[model samples]
Target: MKNVLIISGHPDLQNSIANKTILDEVATALPNAKIRKLDELYPNFNIDVASEQAELLNADVIVWQFPLSWYSMPALMKKWLDDVFLHGFSHGSTAKLGGKKLIVSFTTGAPAVAYQHDAVMKHTVDEFCYQFETTAILCGLDLQPIVYTNGVSYSARQTAEQIAGQKDLAKEHAKRLITAIQAA
Candidate 1:
Protein backbone atom coordinates (compact mmCIF):
# COMPACT_ATOMS: atom_id res chain seq x y z
CA MET A 1 0.00 0.00 0.00
CA LYS A 2 1.22 3.51 -0.79
CA ASN A 3 1.88 5.93 2.02
CA VAL A 4 -1.04 8.34 2.28
CA LEU A 5 -0.93 11.76 3.85
CA ILE A 6 -4.11 13.56 4.85
CA ILE A 7 -3.84 17.29 5.41
CA SER A 8 -6.97 18.25 7.31
CA GLY A 9 -7.72 21.94 7.13
CA HIS A 10 -10.80 22.31 9.27
CA PRO A 11 -10.68 25.52 11.30
CA ASP A 12 -12.78 24.21 14.17
CA LEU A 13 -12.74 20.48 14.15
CA GLN A 14 -14.48 20.00 17.49
CA ASN A 15 -17.58 21.85 16.39
CA SER A 16 -17.64 20.32 12.94
CA ILE A 17 -20.13 17.61 12.00
CA ALA A 18 -19.41 16.64 8.41
CA ASN A 19 -15.67 17.19 8.35
CA LYS A 20 -15.12 15.52 11.69
CA THR A 21 -17.26 12.54 10.73
CA ILE A 22 -15.44 12.10 7.44
CA LEU A 23 -12.07 12.35 9.15
CA ASP A 24 -12.99 9.83 11.81
CA GLU A 25 -14.16 7.38 9.19
CA VAL A 26 -11.02 7.84 7.13
CA ALA A 27 -8.80 7.29 10.15
CA THR A 28 -10.67 4.14 11.09
CA ALA A 29 -10.71 2.80 7.54
CA LEU A 30 -7.11 3.64 6.65
CA PRO A 31 -5.12 3.11 9.80
CA ASN A 32 -1.85 3.50 7.99
CA ALA A 33 -2.61 6.96 6.63
CA LYS A 34 -0.92 9.92 8.32
CA ILE A 35 -3.28 12.76 9.18
CA ARG A 36 -2.16 16.30 9.97
CA LYS A 37 -4.79 18.61 11.34
CA LEU A 38 -3.53 21.99 10.19
CA ASP A 39 -5.59 24.14 12.51
CA GLU A 40 -4.51 22.12 15.54
CA LEU A 41 -0.89 22.16 14.48
CA TYR A 42 -0.84 25.86 13.76
CA PRO A 43 -3.49 27.52 15.86
CA ASN A 44 -1.58 30.78 15.64
CA PHE A 45 -1.04 30.16 11.94
CA ASN A 46 2.68 29.73 12.41
CA ILE A 47 3.59 26.86 10.14
CA ASP A 48 6.76 24.82 10.48
CA VAL A 49 7.83 24.82 6.88
CA ALA A 50 10.54 22.17 7.13
CA SER A 51 8.32 19.75 9.01
CA GLU A 52 5.50 20.22 6.51
CA GLN A 53 7.90 19.64 3.64
CA ALA A 54 9.16 16.48 5.29
CA GLU A 55 5.66 15.10 5.59
CA LEU A 56 4.94 15.79 1.94
CA LEU A 57 8.21 14.18 0.86
CA ASN A 58 7.44 11.02 2.79
CA ALA A 59 4.01 10.43 1.32
CA ASP A 60 3.01 9.00 -2.05
CA VAL A 61 -0.60 10.14 -2.01
CA ILE A 62 -1.55 13.50 -0.52
CA VAL A 63 -5.13 14.36 0.39
CA TRP A 64 -6.26 17.87 1.16
CA GLN A 65 -9.30 17.56 3.38
CA PHE A 66 -11.20 20.65 4.42
CA PRO A 67 -14.52 22.40 4.73
CA LEU A 68 -15.15 24.81 1.91
CA SER A 69 -15.12 28.33 3.25
CA TRP A 70 -16.36 31.11 0.98
CA TYR A 71 -16.02 28.75 -1.97
CA SER A 72 -12.42 27.93 -1.09
CA MET A 73 -10.24 26.36 1.57
CA PRO A 74 -9.64 27.73 5.03
CA ALA A 75 -7.01 30.46 5.46
CA LEU A 76 -4.44 28.19 7.09
CA MET A 77 -4.51 25.77 4.20
CA LYS A 78 -3.68 28.57 1.80
CA LYS A 79 -0.87 29.55 4.12
CA TRP A 80 0.35 25.96 4.17
CA LEU A 81 0.63 25.93 0.41
CA ASP A 82 2.45 29.24 0.47
CA ASP A 83 4.90 28.16 3.13
CA VAL A 84 5.67 24.56 2.18
CA PHE A 85 5.35 24.60 -1.59
CA LEU A 86 8.43 26.64 -2.30
CA HIS A 87 9.89 27.35 -5.69
CA GLY A 88 12.76 24.88 -5.56
CA PHE A 89 10.92 22.13 -3.74
CA SER A 90 7.47 22.22 -5.32
CA HIS A 91 8.46 23.60 -8.66
CA GLY A 92 11.51 24.86 -10.54
CA SER A 93 14.59 22.74 -11.39
CA THR A 94 14.98 21.18 -7.95
CA ALA A 95 11.31 20.30 -7.50
CA LYS A 96 10.95 17.37 -5.16
CA LEU A 97 7.16 17.17 -5.30
CA GLY A 98 6.92 16.30 -8.95
CA GLY A 99 4.84 13.23 -9.76
CA LYS A 100 3.19 13.10 -6.34
CA LYS A 101 -0.54 12.30 -6.37
CA LEU A 102 -2.88 15.01 -5.10
CA ILE A 103 -6.49 14.54 -4.09
CA VAL A 104 -8.75 17.33 -2.86
CA SER A 105 -11.69 16.39 -0.67
CA PHE A 106 -13.99 18.92 0.91
CA THR A 107 -17.36 19.51 2.55
CA THR A 108 -19.58 22.34 1.41
CA GLY A 109 -22.35 23.99 3.33
CA ALA A 110 -24.14 24.71 0.08
CA PRO A 111 -26.08 21.99 -1.66
CA ALA A 112 -24.71 20.55 -4.91
CA VAL A 113 -27.54 22.15 -6.81
CA ALA A 114 -26.48 25.57 -5.56
CA TYR A 115 -23.26 25.20 -7.52
CA GLN A 116 -25.01 24.91 -10.84
CA HIS A 117 -24.64 27.79 -13.29
CA ASP A 118 -28.30 28.74 -13.08
CA ALA A 119 -28.43 28.20 -9.33
CA VAL A 120 -27.69 30.59 -6.49
CA MET A 121 -23.89 30.40 -6.71
CA LYS A 122 -23.92 30.55 -10.49
CA HIS A 123 -20.88 28.27 -10.80
CA THR A 124 -19.95 24.66 -10.27
CA VAL A 125 -17.66 23.48 -7.52
CA ASP A 126 -15.15 22.42 -10.14
CA GLU A 127 -15.20 25.92 -11.57
CA PHE A 128 -14.26 27.37 -8.21
CA CYS A 129 -11.40 24.86 -7.94
CA TYR A 130 -9.50 25.89 -11.02
CA GLN A 131 -6.77 27.49 -8.97
CA PHE A 132 -6.11 24.27 -7.07
CA GLU A 133 -6.09 22.28 -10.28
CA THR A 134 -3.69 24.75 -11.82
CA THR A 135 -1.44 24.51 -8.81
CA ALA A 136 -1.25 20.74 -9.24
CA ILE A 137 -0.41 21.18 -12.90
CA LEU A 138 2.30 23.71 -12.19
CA CYS A 139 3.84 21.53 -9.50
CA GLY A 140 3.71 18.48 -11.73
CA LEU A 141 1.51 16.59 -9.30
CA ASP A 142 -0.97 14.08 -10.64
CA LEU A 143 -4.28 15.65 -9.73
CA GLN A 144 -7.10 13.28 -8.89
CA PRO A 145 -10.79 13.97 -9.33
CA ILE A 146 -12.23 15.98 -6.48
CA VAL A 147 -14.37 14.45 -3.75
CA TYR A 148 -16.95 16.61 -2.03
CA THR A 149 -19.85 16.39 0.41
CA ASN A 150 -22.51 19.00 -0.13
CA GLY A 151 -25.67 20.11 1.72
CA VAL A 152 -23.84 19.96 5.00
CA SER A 153 -25.47 23.12 6.30
CA TYR A 154 -28.88 21.57 5.77
CA SER A 155 -28.19 19.37 8.80
CA ALA A 156 -27.24 22.27 11.05
CA ARG A 157 -30.63 22.72 12.74
CA GLN A 158 -31.82 19.15 12.18
CA THR A 159 -33.24 16.72 14.72
CA ALA A 160 -31.32 13.79 16.22
CA GLU A 161 -32.47 11.36 13.56
CA GLN A 162 -31.60 13.80 10.80
CA ILE A 163 -28.14 14.40 12.27
CA ALA A 164 -27.59 10.66 12.34
CA GLY A 165 -28.47 10.55 8.68
CA GLN A 166 -25.89 13.25 8.00
CA LYS A 167 -23.26 11.23 9.80
CA ASP A 168 -24.18 8.24 7.64
CA LEU A 169 -23.75 10.39 4.57
CA ALA A 170 -20.31 11.43 5.72
CA LYS A 171 -19.39 7.81 6.24
CA GLU A 172 -20.41 7.00 2.70
CA HIS A 173 -18.30 9.86 1.41
CA ALA A 174 -15.39 8.58 3.49
CA LYS A 175 -15.78 5.14 1.95
CA ARG A 176 -15.65 6.73 -1.47
CA LEU A 177 -12.50 8.61 -0.44
CA ILE A 178 -10.89 5.35 0.68
CA THR A 179 -11.75 3.79 -2.65
CA ALA A 180 -10.16 6.76 -4.41
CA ILE A 181 -7.04 6.48 -2.31
CA GLN A 182 -6.80 2.76 -2.98
CA ALA A 183 -7.01 3.44 -6.69
CA ALA A 184 -4.29 6.05 -6.36
Candidate 2:
Protein backbone atom coordinates (compact mmCIF):
# COMPACT_ATOMS: atom_id res chain seq x y z
CA MET A 1 0.00 0.00 0.00
CA LYS A 2 1.34 3.42 -0.89
CA ASN A 3 1.72 5.82 2.02
CA VAL A 4 -0.74 8.68 1.83
CA LEU A 5 -0.07 11.93 3.66
CA ILE A 6 -2.92 14.37 4.12
CA ILE A 7 -1.90 17.84 5.20
CA SER A 8 -4.71 19.78 6.83
CA GLY A 9 -4.05 23.47 6.15
CA HIS A 10 -7.06 24.82 7.98
CA PRO A 11 -5.64 27.39 10.42
CA ASP A 12 -8.09 26.44 13.18
CA LEU A 13 -9.95 23.29 12.29
CA GLN A 14 -11.65 23.09 15.69
CA ASN A 15 -13.62 26.24 14.90
CA SER A 16 -14.63 24.89 11.49
CA ILE A 17 -17.71 22.94 10.56
CA ALA A 18 -17.42 22.08 6.87
CA ASN A 19 -13.65 21.69 6.82
CA LYS A 20 -13.64 19.67 10.03
CA THR A 21 -16.37 17.41 8.73
CA ILE A 22 -14.49 16.89 5.48
CA LEU A 23 -11.31 15.90 7.30
CA ASP A 24 -13.16 13.59 9.67
CA GLU A 25 -14.82 11.81 6.77
CA VAL A 26 -11.54 11.54 4.91
CA ALA A 27 -9.79 10.10 7.96
CA THR A 28 -12.51 7.50 8.38
CA ALA A 29 -12.39 6.56 4.71
CA LEU A 30 -8.62 6.35 4.44
CA PRO A 31 -7.65 4.97 7.78
CA ASN A 32 -4.01 4.47 6.86
CA ALA A 33 -3.59 7.98 5.54
CA LYS A 34 -1.60 10.35 7.73
CA ILE A 35 -3.56 13.54 8.23
CA ARG A 36 -1.35 16.29 9.60
CA LYS A 37 -3.31 19.11 11.14
CA LEU A 38 -1.21 22.24 10.75
CA ASP A 39 -3.04 24.29 13.35
CA GLU A 40 -2.57 21.67 16.03
CA LEU A 41 0.99 20.94 15.01
CA TYR A 42 2.23 24.48 14.77
CA PRO A 43 0.15 27.02 16.62
CA ASN A 44 3.02 29.44 17.12
CA PHE A 45 3.77 29.58 13.35
CA ASN A 46 7.17 28.06 13.95
CA ILE A 47 7.35 25.02 11.72
CA ASP A 48 9.70 22.12 12.23
CA VAL A 49 11.28 22.05 8.79
CA ALA A 50 13.06 18.72 9.15
CA SER A 51 9.99 16.93 10.45
CA GLU A 52 7.82 18.32 7.67
CA GLN A 53 10.38 17.29 5.06
CA ALA A 54 10.54 13.84 6.54
CA GLU A 55 6.77 13.50 6.25
CA LEU A 56 7.03 14.53 2.61
CA LEU A 57 9.75 12.02 1.94
CA ASN A 58 7.73 9.16 3.41
CA ALA A 59 4.62 9.83 1.40
CA ASP A 60 3.62 8.49 -2.00
CA VAL A 61 0.55 10.69 -2.11
CA ILE A 62 0.16 14.15 -0.56
CA VAL A 63 -3.22 15.77 -0.06
CA TRP A 64 -3.50 19.46 0.81
CA GLN A 65 -6.85 20.17 2.49
CA PHE A 66 -7.81 23.67 3.48
CA PRO A 67 -10.37 26.41 3.17
CA LEU A 68 -9.36 28.73 0.35
CA SER A 69 -7.91 31.96 1.64
CA TRP A 70 -7.57 35.02 -0.58
CA TYR A 71 -7.54 32.80 -3.70
CA SER A 72 -4.67 30.76 -2.26
CA MET A 73 -3.67 28.57 0.67
CA PRO A 74 -3.92 29.81 4.24
CA ALA A 75 -1.05 31.84 5.72
CA LEU A 76 0.09 28.99 7.97
CA MET A 77 0.20 26.52 5.11
CA LYS A 78 2.03 29.07 2.96
CA LYS A 79 4.61 29.49 5.67
CA TRP A 80 4.95 25.71 5.85
CA LEU A 81 5.65 25.57 2.13
CA ASP A 82 8.22 28.34 2.43
CA ASP A 83 9.99 26.81 5.41
CA VAL A 84 9.80 23.16 4.32
CA PHE A 85 9.96 23.01 0.52
CA LEU A 86 13.50 24.33 0.13
CA HIS A 87 16.08 23.88 -2.60
CA GLY A 88 18.05 20.61 -2.75
CA PHE A 89 15.03 18.96 -1.16
CA SER A 90 11.75 19.74 -2.89
CA HIS A 91 12.81 21.50 -6.10
CA GLY A 92 16.52 21.37 -6.88
CA SER A 93 19.50 19.07 -6.36
CA THR A 94 18.18 15.89 -4.77
CA ALA A 95 14.52 16.54 -5.64
CA LYS A 96 13.46 14.12 -2.96
CA LEU A 97 9.76 14.78 -3.38
CA GLY A 98 9.77 14.12 -7.11
CA GLY A 99 7.07 11.90 -8.59
CA LYS A 100 4.74 12.07 -5.60
CA LYS A 101 1.04 12.52 -6.27
CA LEU A 102 -0.29 15.89 -5.11
CA ILE A 103 -3.98 16.48 -4.51
CA VAL A 104 -5.20 20.03 -3.87
CA SER A 105 -8.54 19.90 -2.12
CA PHE A 106 -10.29 22.94 -0.72
CA THR A 107 -13.64 24.54 0.13
CA THR A 108 -14.75 28.05 -0.71
CA GLY A 109 -17.21 30.48 0.86
CA ALA A 110 -18.59 31.69 -2.46
CA PRO A 111 -21.07 29.78 -4.57
CA ALA A 112 -20.20 28.07 -7.85
CA VAL A 113 -21.92 30.78 -9.88
CA ALA A 114 -19.67 33.37 -8.34
CA TYR A 115 -16.60 31.71 -9.89
CA GLN A 116 -17.71 31.92 -13.50
CA HIS A 117 -16.15 34.18 -16.12
CA ASP A 118 -18.90 36.81 -15.82
CA ALA A 119 -19.46 36.40 -12.10
CA VAL A 120 -18.42 38.37 -9.05
CA MET A 121 -14.93 36.82 -8.68
CA LYS A 122 -14.47 37.09 -12.45
CA HIS A 123 -12.57 33.80 -12.81
CA THR A 124 -12.95 30.09 -12.20
CA VAL A 125 -11.37 28.33 -9.23
CA ASP A 126 -9.19 26.42 -11.66
CA GLU A 127 -7.70 29.71 -12.82
CA PHE A 128 -6.75 30.49 -9.24
CA CYS A 129 -5.13 27.04 -9.01
CA TYR A 130 -2.29 28.15 -11.28
CA GLN A 131 -0.03 28.60 -8.28
CA PHE A 132 -0.68 25.01 -7.23
CA GLU A 133 0.08 23.86 -10.77
CA THR A 134 3.35 25.77 -10.61
CA THR A 135 4.17 24.17 -7.30
CA ALA A 136 3.56 20.67 -8.67
CA ILE A 137 5.75 21.34 -11.69
CA LEU A 138 8.55 22.78 -9.60
CA CYS A 139 8.44 19.89 -7.16
CA GLY A 140 8.03 17.27 -9.90
CA LEU A 141 4.86 16.00 -8.27
CA ASP A 142 1.99 14.54 -10.26
CA LEU A 143 -0.85 16.93 -9.59
CA GLN A 144 -4.35 15.52 -9.56
CA PRO A 145 -7.59 17.24 -10.54
CA ILE A 146 -8.52 19.50 -7.67
CA VAL A 147 -11.46 18.75 -5.36
CA TYR A 148 -13.28 21.99 -4.62
CA THR A 149 -16.60 22.40 -2.82
CA ASN A 150 -18.31 25.75 -3.17
CA GLY A 151 -20.68 27.76 -0.94
CA VAL A 152 -19.90 25.95 2.29
CA SER A 153 -19.34 29.11 4.29
CA TYR A 154 -20.74 29.34 7.78
CA SER A 155 -20.81 33.11 7.62
CA ALA A 156 -23.00 33.05 4.52
CA ARG A 157 -25.21 30.46 6.18
CA GLN A 158 -27.07 31.58 9.32
CA THR A 159 -29.67 28.98 10.22
CA ALA A 160 -29.60 25.53 11.80
CA GLU A 161 -30.97 24.04 8.60
CA GLN A 162 -28.35 25.83 6.50
CA ILE A 163 -25.51 24.60 8.70
CA ALA A 164 -26.82 21.04 8.58
CA GLY A 165 -27.15 21.30 4.81
CA GLN A 166 -23.56 22.46 4.47
CA LYS A 167 -22.38 19.63 6.69
CA ASP A 168 -24.06 17.16 4.36
CA LEU A 169 -22.34 18.88 1.44
CA ALA A 170 -19.04 18.54 3.23
CA LYS A 171 -19.56 14.78 3.57
CA GLU A 172 -20.27 14.53 -0.14
CA HIS A 173 -17.17 16.57 -0.77
CA ALA A 174 -15.15 14.09 1.26
CA LYS A 175 -16.48 11.19 -0.77
CA ARG A 176 -15.61 12.93 -4.02
CA LEU A 177 -12.15 13.73 -2.70
CA ILE A 178 -11.68 10.10 -1.63
CA THR A 179 -12.60 8.89 -5.09
CA ALA A 180 -10.13 11.30 -6.61
CA ILE A 181 -7.39 10.19 -4.24
CA GLN A 182 -8.06 6.52 -4.92
CA ALA A 183 -7.86 7.17 -8.65
CA ALA A 184 -4.63 9.09 -8.27
Candidate 3:
Protein backbone atom coordinates (compact mmCIF):
# COMPACT_ATOMS: atom_id res chain seq x y z
CA MET A 1 0.00 0.00 0.00
CA LYS A 2 1.17 3.50 -0.74
CA ASN A 3 1.92 5.79 2.18
CA VAL A 4 -1.14 7.92 2.89
CA LEU A 5 -1.04 11.46 4.23
CA ILE A 6 -4.21 12.87 5.77
CA ILE A 7 -4.25 16.66 5.99
CA SER A 8 -7.08 17.46 8.37
CA GLY A 9 -8.44 21.00 8.03
CA HIS A 10 -11.08 21.19 10.74
CA PRO A 11 -10.89 24.58 12.42
CA ASP A 12 -11.96 23.15 15.78
CA LEU A 13 -11.68 19.43 15.94
CA GLN A 14 -12.40 19.26 19.66
CA ASN A 15 -15.90 20.52 19.07
CA SER A 16 -16.48 18.38 15.98
CA ILE A 17 -18.33 15.10 16.04
CA ALA A 18 -18.19 13.88 12.46
CA ASN A 19 -14.75 15.05 11.37
CA LYS A 20 -12.98 13.91 14.51
CA THR A 21 -14.63 10.51 14.41
CA ILE A 22 -13.70 10.01 10.77
CA LEU A 23 -10.10 10.98 11.39
CA ASP A 24 -9.85 8.66 14.34
CA GLU A 25 -11.36 5.80 12.38
CA VAL A 26 -8.95 6.32 9.49
CA ALA A 27 -5.97 6.45 11.82
CA THR A 28 -7.03 3.27 13.53
CA ALA A 29 -7.80 1.42 10.30
CA LEU A 30 -4.64 2.56 8.60
CA PRO A 31 -2.02 2.50 11.29
CA ASN A 32 0.81 3.58 8.99
CA ALA A 33 -0.97 6.62 7.63
CA LYS A 34 0.33 10.06 8.59
CA ILE A 35 -2.46 12.33 9.82
CA ARG A 36 -1.62 16.03 10.05
CA LYS A 37 -4.12 18.26 11.81
CA LEU A 38 -3.51 21.68 10.26
CA ASP A 39 -5.32 23.58 13.00
CA GLU A 40 -3.07 22.04 15.63
CA LEU A 41 0.11 22.62 13.61
CA TYR A 42 -0.62 26.15 12.45
CA PRO A 43 -3.12 27.71 14.81
CA ASN A 44 -2.13 31.19 13.66
CA PHE A 45 -2.66 30.20 10.02
CA ASN A 46 1.04 30.74 9.47
CA ILE A 47 1.92 27.66 7.44
CA ASP A 48 5.47 26.34 7.17
CA VAL A 49 5.68 25.93 3.41
CA ALA A 50 8.95 24.02 3.37
CA SER A 51 7.82 21.51 5.98
CA GLU A 52 4.44 20.97 4.29
CA GLN A 53 6.11 20.47 0.94
CA ALA A 54 8.43 17.95 2.48
CA GLU A 55 5.44 16.04 3.87
CA LEU A 56 3.79 16.06 0.48
CA LEU A 57 6.93 14.70 -1.14
CA ASN A 58 7.05 11.76 1.25
CA ALA A 59 3.49 10.60 0.65
CA ASP A 60 2.00 8.81 -2.34
CA VAL A 61 -1.63 9.55 -1.53
CA ILE A 62 -2.78 12.88 -0.12
CA VAL A 63 -6.16 13.13 1.58
CA TRP A 64 -7.67 16.52 2.37
CA GLN A 65 -9.97 15.80 5.30
CA PHE A 66 -12.26 18.41 6.80
CA PRO A 67 -15.77 19.47 7.60
CA LEU A 68 -17.45 21.47 4.85
CA SER A 69 -17.71 25.08 5.91
CA TRP A 70 -19.79 27.50 3.85
CA TYR A 71 -19.90 25.00 0.99
CA SER A 72 -16.08 24.87 0.93
CA MET A 73 -13.08 24.23 3.13
CA PRO A 74 -12.16 26.25 6.21
CA ALA A 75 -9.97 29.36 6.02
CA LEU A 76 -6.84 27.65 7.28
CA MET A 77 -7.13 24.92 4.65
CA LYS A 78 -7.41 27.47 1.88
CA LYS A 79 -4.43 29.27 3.31
CA TRP A 80 -2.44 26.06 3.47
CA LEU A 81 -3.19 25.36 -0.17
CA ASP A 82 -2.35 28.87 -1.22
CA ASP A 83 0.87 28.91 0.77
CA VAL A 84 2.12 25.39 0.17
CA PHE A 85 1.01 24.61 -3.36
CA LEU A 86 3.35 27.10 -4.95
CA HIS A 87 4.02 27.60 -8.66
CA GLY A 88 7.33 25.75 -8.82
CA PHE A 89 6.50 22.98 -6.41
CA SER A 90 2.93 22.23 -7.43
CA HIS A 91 2.59 23.46 -10.99
CA GLY A 92 5.69 24.77 -12.74
CA SER A 93 8.83 23.03 -14.02
CA THR A 94 10.07 22.13 -10.55
CA ALA A 95 6.81 20.39 -9.67
CA LYS A 96 7.31 17.14 -7.83
CA LEU A 97 3.70 16.22 -6.93
CA GLY A 98 2.86 14.71 -10.29
CA GLY A 99 1.28 11.29 -10.28
CA LYS A 100 0.45 11.53 -6.60
CA LYS A 101 -3.20 10.80 -5.81
CA LEU A 102 -5.49 13.32 -4.11
CA ILE A 103 -8.63 12.36 -2.23
CA VAL A 104 -11.06 14.89 -0.80
CA SER A 105 -12.91 13.52 2.23
CA PHE A 106 -15.33 15.69 4.13
CA THR A 107 -18.47 15.86 6.23
CA THR A 108 -21.38 18.11 5.45
CA GLY A 109 -24.08 19.38 7.75
CA ALA A 110 -26.54 19.40 4.87
CA PRO A 111 -28.09 16.18 3.75
CA ALA A 112 -27.43 14.68 0.32
CA VAL A 113 -30.91 15.67 -0.80
CA ALA A 114 -30.09 19.27 -0.02
CA TYR A 115 -27.33 19.24 -2.63
CA GLN A 116 -29.60 18.29 -5.50
CA HIS A 117 -30.85 20.57 -8.25
CA ASP A 118 -34.35 20.72 -6.82
CA ALA A 119 -33.13 21.03 -3.27
CA VAL A 120 -32.61 24.16 -1.18
CA MET A 121 -28.84 24.26 -1.77
CA LYS A 122 -29.29 23.79 -5.53
CA HIS A 123 -25.95 22.18 -6.31
CA THR A 124 -24.50 18.73 -5.95
CA VAL A 125 -21.58 18.15 -3.61
CA ASP A 126 -19.37 17.23 -6.56
CA GLU A 127 -20.25 20.52 -8.25
CA PHE A 128 -19.03 22.40 -5.19
CA CYS A 129 -15.79 20.41 -5.36
CA TYR A 130 -14.83 21.32 -8.91
CA GLN A 131 -12.03 23.56 -7.70
CA PHE A 132 -10.28 20.62 -6.11
CA GLU A 133 -10.45 18.81 -9.46
CA THR A 134 -8.86 21.76 -11.22
CA THR A 135 -6.17 21.95 -8.57
CA ALA A 136 -5.35 18.28 -9.11
CA ILE A 137 -5.11 18.81 -12.84
CA LEU A 138 -2.86 21.82 -12.45
CA CYS A 139 -0.62 19.99 -10.01
CA GLY A 140 -0.56 16.87 -12.22
CA LEU A 141 -1.94 14.83 -9.39
CA ASP A 142 -4.33 11.95 -9.95
CA LEU A 143 -7.78 12.85 -8.64
CA GLN A 144 -9.57 10.15 -6.74
CA PRO A 145 -13.30 9.89 -6.15
CA ILE A 146 -14.34 11.86 -3.08
CA VAL A 147 -15.47 10.17 0.12
CA TYR A 148 -17.93 12.16 2.17
CA THR A 149 -20.52 11.95 4.93
CA ASN A 150 -23.60 14.11 4.72
CA GLY A 151 -26.48 14.99 7.07
CA VAL A 152 -24.06 15.02 9.93
CA SER A 153 -25.61 18.06 11.56
CA TYR A 154 -28.86 18.72 9.78
CA SER A 155 -30.72 19.17 13.05
CA ALA A 156 -29.95 21.68 15.73
CA ARG A 157 -30.83 19.35 18.57
CA GLN A 158 -28.87 16.12 18.64
CA THR A 159 -30.45 13.25 20.50
CA ALA A 160 -28.47 10.26 21.74
CA GLU A 161 -29.63 8.16 18.77
CA GLN A 162 -28.71 10.88 16.29
CA ILE A 163 -25.24 11.23 17.78
CA ALA A 164 -24.69 7.49 17.60
CA GLY A 165 -25.83 7.46 13.99
CA GLN A 166 -23.41 10.21 13.12
CA LYS A 167 -20.54 8.26 14.59
CA ASP A 168 -21.50 5.20 12.57
CA LEU A 169 -21.71 7.30 9.43
CA ALA A 170 -18.27 8.73 10.08
CA LYS A 171 -16.82 5.25 10.44
CA GLU A 172 -18.29 4.28 7.10
CA HIS A 173 -16.88 7.37 5.50
CA ALA A 174 -13.45 6.58 6.89
CA LYS A 175 -13.65 3.07 5.45
CA ARG A 176 -14.48 4.51 2.06
CA LEU A 177 -11.47 6.83 2.35
CA ILE A 178 -9.23 3.88 3.15
CA THR A 179 -10.51 2.07 0.08
CA ALA A 180 -9.84 5.10 -2.08
CA ILE A 181 -6.28 5.40 -0.78
CA GLN A 182 -5.58 1.73 -1.29
CA ALA A 183 -6.85 1.99 -4.84
CA ALA A 184 -4.52 4.91 -5.38
- Highest-TM-score candidate: 2
**Which residue pairs show backbone clashes in model 3?**
none
Worst 10 residues of 3 by lDDT: 153-162
Q: After superposition, how far is residue 11 of candidate 3 from its true place, in Å?
A: 0.4
lDDT tens digits by residue: candidate 1, 83-133: 999999999989999899999999888889899999999999989999889
Candidate 1 clash pair list: none
Query: What lDDT score goes with residue 103 in model 3?
Result: 96
Task: Tell me the lDDT of candidate 1.
Answer: 0.91
lDDT per residue, candidate 3, 1-184, as tens digits? 6888999999988888889999998888889999999999999999999999999999999999998999989999999999999999999998999999999999999889999999999899989999889999999999999888889984732788888898888888888888888888
Ten-residue region with minimum lDDT total, candidate 2: 152-161
User: What value does the lDDT take at residue 10 in candidate 3?
Assistant: 96
The clash count of every prediction, one per candidate, is 0, 0, 0
How close is every model to the real structure, measured as TM-score? Answer: 0.96, 0.98, 0.96
Worst 10 residues of 1 by lDDT: 153-162
What's the CA error at residue 8 for candidate 1, in Å? 0.2
Higher-ranked by TM-score: 2 or 3: 2
Model 2: per-residue lDDT, tens digit, 31-142? Answer: 9999999999999999999999999999999999999999999999999999999999999878899999999999999999999999999999999999999999999999
Whole-model lDDT, model 3? 0.91
